[model samples]
Target: MAQKQNTLRVGLVGAGIGGLAAAIAIARAGADVTVLEAAQELGEIGAGIQMTPNAARLLRAWGVDKVIGDNLVRFEELNLRRKDGTKVGGGPTIRVEKTLGQPWWLVHRAHLHEGLVDVARKNGCDIHIDSRVASISYQTPGPVQVQTERGATFSFDLLIGSDGVGSIVRRTLFPSVKPSPPTTNCAYRAVVPYSQIRKDPSLVELVSKPTMEVWMAPHAYIITYPISAGKDFNMVLSHHRPNPVIAVEDVDMNDFRNDYRDFDPRIRKIIDMVPTAKRWPLLVTGPLDTWSSPQKNVVLMGDAAHSMVNHMAQGAATAMEDGAFLGRVLRETVSGRLSLAEAITIYEKSRMPKAYFKQQVSFLNGYIWHLPEGQAAINRDKAMEVELKGEQPMRTPNLYVDPTTVLEVYGYDAEADADEAIRSFLEQHESKDESTGITKKEADKILNWFLPEEERFLIPSKF
Candidate 1:
């Protein structure tokens, strides 16, 4: 089987980073694609979204940097601290873009989204607003139909569920399951103007320039970095909780004076500086039993696949890397000698193990974040002691599988690969078919066989 063009059509069910990136990838591959978003306006709020070295390479290819040139900022260092604002560890930050032969940048969430949308449409994807993906059916040779919220029905060569954790596409295809519960942890998210916080002697160190800072406290952590150049700061405060999941929309920023009372005095000062905030209850997703639909044509991606705790900051980055890799896998399978099943097989075989490893690592990090109060103090003291004794500072471990190592994933161009994959997929399907077209029994066999016994759900690169 070789790549074929039978109108390589794709239906994407989300307009966030994953869906948008996939749209750019597939459309670049010369496939006709449609991106659907449930929200009337698909944009994330203000913040510094970091793109590590690995993921940045693909963005360079997608022209993300040039699109957000002035709006994005690059961090110059990574600094760590003890709970009470005591300096515990420090080091020169690796310039992700320079290290990986691409640009690593931070931008307001809205800016990144708008840039991606613009490029996606420029590349020829049909993006629809407020067209929620209600249900997906794939009783046909490929993805058969997708029913929309507006009572619209459409068919495509493939249907991708890039929707978030509550993916309706996933719900309709897989068995019913309850949502993940809060883990007694929560994050206070804020996007504040640089001009305001820049006045605080302690806080000003953060945004008077471009850098990423992680101030660890006895029971919680604070992260702040530049996004959209020096225009704003993306700040988040995480706390140790027997439970931490607080929905952002449900939060009252004014009450935090009490919420963080027992913690470090410096943290209280930081909280006071934050005039507005969103609360997101930290929730942990159990390891997915499997992520593919019975049809195999409809598979989950990004948070819909595996939503991880933000401990690693690889959530969105992971999704971007996944999109690039997915495009690569298709390109490899279809453009060359493998069948469609063969192509997907290559993809799962290559990606599942790594994805599973990262998922488990996220779980482990969550355990670290939830270290018991007294135990947390002990660990902090130990870390602090080591820093003092060694006369050297501790560094942030690459808790993530660096996105830059993905020469095998996003490195390959989606267009060239898709051209090849389409032919290969079609040939394989053609070889297995009869003039009478697919018989019911044969169709069932194909569907069942293509439906992997188990598939790993992957999230974004801090994606």
Candidate 2:
């Protein structure tokens, strides 16, 4: 396929979900997209990921949803319980779908990655595996250049750093920025096959139908949901790290069992069923002061931009939103209506506040979910109980049912937000037409560049 006229040559580092999502969105917007992956092969190593409505909307738009098809499980509800199986709060998620026009989904991370890879390739993205970026050059009057470890060099008009938490691209952009200190929390992840869950009567309720179950207690919480179309049950247990060293390692089964031994009996049963589990020390990077370089040619996305605590489970979703918004804004550059610098600035301006908000909220949620057995915990439970009993619609401790948070997080539309930002940019620049040379007619055209509503949600046939 021929490249679109005046389209950007985008070199994106990282082929993880965020990178691939950006590649797909950019390629779909008629840019030449090349993705560089450090790994020897393409795949995700994690167990499960929650696809909130915000992320799910982008997946459907990119035609990735169909590619993910049966691998996804659309969960009906979220159940929030005390550590000892006492119900606290959480309600059906069906209303989220109704309110947002997108369903909340759960899927194996590998399946989601595969689907994104397939859709990205179908959309004409070039993905190079085993192509670790060794260095990047940001020359003022020339294209940004990237050198791979294997001695191959690639050049592009724009460079996106989606390389994750330890992003080399990010370091090159802001070398003066210091690394964030590791948090005290660590997470243990495991998957129990649905067959195993079904064999035991005590665990059958977990897989009988799809639901997200969260058991919260002082200094710890465990979240479980069905994945791989309900063929497996995925669990994440977050707790205080016994060892101060921050790393991902195998946890001894006995130690893992002992950690949650005092919790619900059914949880202990699930823990006993697991053969092994991996403990990952939770780490956070910037809610950085800036995500783009001084030149505006190099920018960061996803975890590279802001890797926060996983309490809100919006890390990947926000990254996907970044991809969607970048794609939308860059279309102006592709159409010659906005300069590369202008588009990048608009993207940073539009996305950073919300991304920062999410980062803080995720951190706040960590504190809320792991409250100790005290007056604060009691108050939280009472607020959640009131919401659960339909007594009030005010903000509650339960994020799933928190009206303001749910609307702000799940009902977000990246493309729509981008359009609004672009309009704002045009309006602001148009006021200085004598200096900027942006005529009213040109601004109007740019304002109306969005796709028709009828065609907006249509997936590509190839997908």
Candidate 3:
């Protein structure tokens, strides 16, 4: 397969962080990109998010660092304390910069989303608000048809599903797969303005540092950090619900206070000062069998492919990686260096391992963060103390003692990994082929082999 002279049209469903990032990345690579968002207006919807070095590197490379830099707060450490403010675990995170060559930053979700949207538009991506994708149809040897809610249909060379955990594209692909019910875990998020909290002396101490503060408790934990240039505090409290499944969207001050009644007094006041809070019913999707279509022109990225536990704060970071990595693959495809199948296969192979690995780690992190009263929990605190006292290596027999673990996750380079994957795929296939490289037909056959039988449906049209 050689480069096509015509510009590639890419249609992205969902204009969340992943979709916006993908639009920018694809547009930067000279593809005509359009993003369909179901919302009436695109704005920030979440409280806060951490952008690790791995994700920041991609944002900087995409030339939107400045757009998101204004309200960013650089955190130098991650401090873990008990519910009552007793120091227990975590360590200085400045080493993340040393190991990964980039700094850790926190920003309000709205700021980051706005910046990404602006950058994507500046990159010439057509962002269509209120355009909800109703269905997608594959057309072999031609464009894929994307029908939206408004009874309009558009065709593109590729279709990307960057929608969140409840993804229509994913459902369309695996119609038999139902969304998993909510888990026992539930999270409450609130942002306390520094101007309002500064009046309280007890809360002043909490906001004194740029560190990511984690307060561990029995069957619950709270993570708080500064964002909006340290003008506001981003707080997240994750705890087990009494019921197996509970959906709490509206905020209730009394409920929040009751949940963390035993928490630090300062944190209690911080909770009291919050005007409102949003509750998130933590749900986990079963591991997806596949994230791409048989033809590879249509794919799922971000939460649509692999939604994980948020304990590791890698939700947004992993989504960014998805978009960044896919961008790299599409760039090569646009350049005629590889067929769509080969490029997408390489992307899927390289990204699935990292995404799923993080997903598992995130679940483990939640377990460790919210350990109930037991010898195991006591041992964890003891291990953290030992690591902090320099009496033991960071790799103590506890999840909370390791700083290198953070470095490992935050140091991954999506573009480099994708490039390496492409090289390996080329070498392996070229060796098997008698021609200069794998033909388009050969690439499709390899792709089809990896697809499930259900996905082997024929496209009645030339794609």
What is residue 264's positional error in candidate 1, in angstroms?
5.2
Per-residue lDDT over 114-225 for candidate 2, one digit per residue giving the tens place of the 0 to 100 score: 9999999998999999999999999567899899999999999999999988889988998865445356787899999888778888876666788899999999999999
Per-model TM against the reference: 0.79, 0.91, 0.89
Q: For model 3, give the 10-residue run with minimal summed lDDT.
A: 454-463
Per-residue alpha-carbon lDDT of candidate 3 for residues 1-463, written as tens digits (9 for 90 to 100): 5465457889999999888988888888778998999999999687888887888888788877798776878876677888889887666666557767877788888988988998999999998988988888884578899888998889988889898878898887777755443468878888888888888776766677777888889888889998988888899989777665435578667987789999988888888887777778765655676787888878888888877778888877888888888888888788877777877788888888888888888888888878887898788787778646634364753442355665568778887877787777765655333443445456457655676776542432323
**Residue lDDT tens for model 1, 396-461:** 222222233233222323334434554554455553333435443454554545555442122112
- List candidate 1 stretches off by more than 4 Å: 95-99, 140-143, 240-249, 262-267, 332-336, 369-463
Cand. 3 TM to true fold: 0.89
Model 2, TM vs. native = 0.91
RMSD (CA, angstroms), candidate 3: 8.4
Each model's C-alpha lDDT?
0.63, 0.86, 0.79
